[model samples]
Target: MTQQSLSKFEEHLQDILQYRVEKELLIIKNYPRIIADYDRDLIIELMESLLNNVYCFAEKTITITITLQEKLLIIYVKDDGPGFSKKELLTATEPYYFQNKNSHFGLGLTIVEALTQKHVGNLKIVNSIDGGAIVSAVFAIKVENLH
Candidate 1:
């Protein structure tokens, strides 16, 4: 590869690494505040992604949990503010899908799903039992999967 190509690749990798590290720090910093004794980094990161983007996320109601089995892993993040409409949830993850001042804006949950799939997982938006929006994921278990 040319020097320019190498420089671009390095920059891309560095951005990804920095993003991951910043997300990890979010989990570690908020652990005690959210849950008592469980370590759900994936779920935490999902919530953080939403909360970080929305200034009023904490003020709004939120809940998260993890469900796991010997062979499966599930992370759920939920919010009780204005939940997404079906059409909204359906396309919210597509990066800047509904942008523009006159259009509805959303965080890239579609991108989030793609990231989940990289871990051999999937993402879905569902209605919470109580009320609100829920982001559920089903992932696989692997030693190296733990970042």
Candidate 2:
């Protein structure tokens, strides 16, 4: 874990976005400019997994939203795609729970879930009422020198 600025995180996100340029998907980022303590690499991995999963199923746009509430940082990745089925909502975080016939193993959400747990955080998988899939990760923000 290390102290990182959100700008640096955004830059990493841009790099991930570059990889999927051929798909021509629209990505929206909504987050604040603040420093936080976290495992930068793991967080990047979490984002990559989330984005990759969504990118494969999204129709056109994907939205990433981050917000700080109390002492928790909430990160939401949503996609304009066919939302998860009832069973997926319950088992998506389980290892080897693949919904589509892809060459890759179905460990994306499992990895995300593990990383969140490593940070003592939690993960939520749900579908937006309007239409889409939304995956949220919440991590407790560690404040230094509070005294």
Candidate 3:
């Protein structure tokens, strides 16, 4: 590759990182509003799992944080992998549906689904093609709202 091409690639990488940071901020900012009627620990655990697993994917640069406002508990996990197709995101809740062939019985997402439902919100898997997985769960403010 020529020097010019390499420079362009690096510039592109920087732009992508900047974009992910901005997106993460937006999601986290809305946390308090979303969790206005749910549980906190459930949200925390899900966020932790999401980040740990996404970071396991070499292409992903993930961040997990909780910012409470008003009466919501917002947990967002954003990564920098090829993201997921519409189908993969929607089907993540399905039993035994693994995206990559060898993911330990395909229960990662299933657990995500269970926990998400426990929080009374959705567990979403969004595709970040400039490579990542963005998962966020919004729960209400009450501890009793979770299992």
Best model number under TM-score: 2
| Candidate 1: clashing residue pairs, number | 2
Candidates in order, TM-scores: namely 0.55, 0.85, 0.59
Please give the lDDT score at residue 2 for candidate 2: 78
Residue 34, candidate 3: Cα error in Å is 15
Q: Candidate 2 at residue 55, lDDT?
A: 80
lDDT of 1: 0.49
lDDT of 3 by residue, 41-122 (tens): 4644565455445655535245554554444445566766567777877787677877777665566667776887786766
Write down the lDDT that model 3 would get: 0.53
- Candidate 1 — worst ten consecutive residues by lDDT sum? 27-36
Worst 10 residues of 2 by lDDT: 22-31
- Backbone clashes in model 3: 19
lDDT of each: 0.49, 0.80, 0.53
Residue 126 displacement (Å), model 2: 0.5
- lDDT string for model 1 (1-147, tens) is 011211232233335335543232221111111111222344345545544433233234445455545445565666665666677666767777653477545555755677577657778877666666777767664322221
**What TM-score quantifies how close candidate 1 is to the native fold?**
0.55
Better of 2 and 3 by lDDT: 2
lDDT of 2 by residue, 72-132 (tens): 7688988888899999999989998888786467888998999898888999999999999
Give Cα distance to truth, residue 92, candidate 3, Å: 1.6
